[model samples]
Target: MAPDDQPAPPLRRRGARMRSAVLAATVDVLAEHGLAGTTVGAVARAAGVHETSVYRGWRTRENLILEALAEQLDAAVPLPDTGRVRDDLVTYFGALARLLATPQGEALLRLSAERDDTLPDHRLAYWSDRLDRGAVMVARAVERGELPPDTDPGLVIEALAGPLFTRALISGAPLDATLAPRLVDLVLGGASAPKPGA
Candidate 1:
């Protein structure tokens, strides 16, 4: 049996490792240099891989960077499950605030400001999932008799989240520890359903 005739081992392990490394490098570059700076060459150099490999695998630099950013957000953000709705919201949003305060978070915010059309449609779905999670919190509270039975969960979430985002992005205000609860309180202040006959 000639050596060339032997079966070749699978490249699965190496491929997975390289994929992880390349994605991490993309995130690091975006954090340090912003989206415009994370060229394929830059990421390949940072990841210690050949540029051709990245291009062959990811097809485009924009796709790779967006996937990398989405991976980070998916890993970091989770639905809150605490028994109390307000506490759950505060905790959930507090983590988001801290993340948004980082360089990577700031870079993502810049992406939002620039209105990059290259961003995939799935990213919007991710945000919608997050909003649904907030709705779940409101639904749970309603089930527990904490709020009115007919309360609009989406409205409840928007009221709770809008100010937090405003402070983090538009207003340039610090997301102080107390801000989460304050926002929750404001949202909960009118967390009731309209009268059935009204």
Candidate 2:
């Protein structure tokens, strides 16, 4: 039998729908009440599921929140893979900036940060996991001679995103499409430009 002749697999589509419902409801609860408001019972009510169902899938509110956050992140920003490091980074963080400006995104960050005093390790782990890939890409650019080998990728990421975040949250400025690419250009120039002696 040819591959095309094989029967279609079972949809199991309900799993996806249920997961999405939980995540969407979680986002709403987080936005309205912050992290403290997203209890298992609250999420269950919001998702139209029995409290038992939530416990069956996730034993605790923290676990549920983490899973929901991961799902939300998957939708908010796609890490760019363009050959140009600067362009790719700018585009990536630009998307992130836009997300941060949204109601859900802002609420998520604030809620996460609000818990930092109690769970500093969680904050470090979360950022380290999320940022590892981006750091690798910048490091690769340096290895390829596209950037200074000694440059700190962490610092590079901060430079690219710091201004945008500041502008959005602190200065009340826009992360307009035009401004994002321009910021990329400025950072890329600083990273790759020949030094005075070299």
Candidate 3:
């Protein structure tokens, strides 16, 4: 049999590469076109894959977009364990602010805010998962006594992140270098664990 006649690589091996390419393409499309303009055919063309493949893998454009956004967030904003709650939060929110300042990040922020009645539950689930992931920073702070035991991790995260989003998506304010530390200070001031016997 000729080499040309050889069958293509097994689906499992090719699946990984295809998945990565498709996700990357999805992000690029989202950044360039926004959520309303992104389509499976566009992503498939960008990724050099068939439209059916994307449909088969992600089931819908919403799912594809969500997975792509999740991947970007996980990579761009990491959970820090610097042993000091202030430092960890500063570092994490710093990364988040930086990401939000970028065009791609701005697109993601807009996408997250979009309201789709048909996918309200799915959107809530997506936000819930992301908030839960970010809450780890607060959880660690509480464990280390850097924050009060009763501190609400999700609320703390929201408090720190809310202004950043507002600045990026609403106020047209700059996400400057000092912003993260300043926000962290503001939130942590009220949330910090009190000094012993004081």
Question: Model 1, 54-162: lDDT tens per residue?
Answer: 9888998877976787777657767778888877878877777777777787676556455567764655765676778768888998999988998999988887667
Cα lDDT tens digits, model 2, 95-175, are: 887888788887766665565454556666776677776676688788888988798987777777678667755687876
Candidate 3 clashing pairs, residues 3+ apart or interchain: none
Minimal lDDT window, size 10, model 2: 6-15
lDDT of 1 at 173: 87
lDDT of each: 0.75, 0.74, 0.86
Which one is best on lDDT? 3
Q: Can you write out model 3's per-residue Cα lDDT over 70-119, one digit (the tens) per residue?
A: 89988999888888988988999999999999999999888888886645
Q: Say which prediction, candidate 1 or candidate 3, comes out ahead on TM-score.
A: 3
Candidate 1 has an lDDT of: 0.75
In the order shown, the candidates' Cα RMSDs to the true structure are 7.5, 7.2, 5.0
Which wins on TM-score, candidate 1 or candidate 2? 2
Query: What TM-score, computed on C-alpha atoms, does each candidate reach?
Result: 0.77, 0.79, 0.86
Q: Which ten residues in a row have the lowest lDDT in candidate 1?
A: 6-15
Candidate 1 residue-pair clash tally: 0
- Answer with 2 or 3, whichever has the higher lDDT: 3
Per-residue lDDT value at 92 in model 3: 91
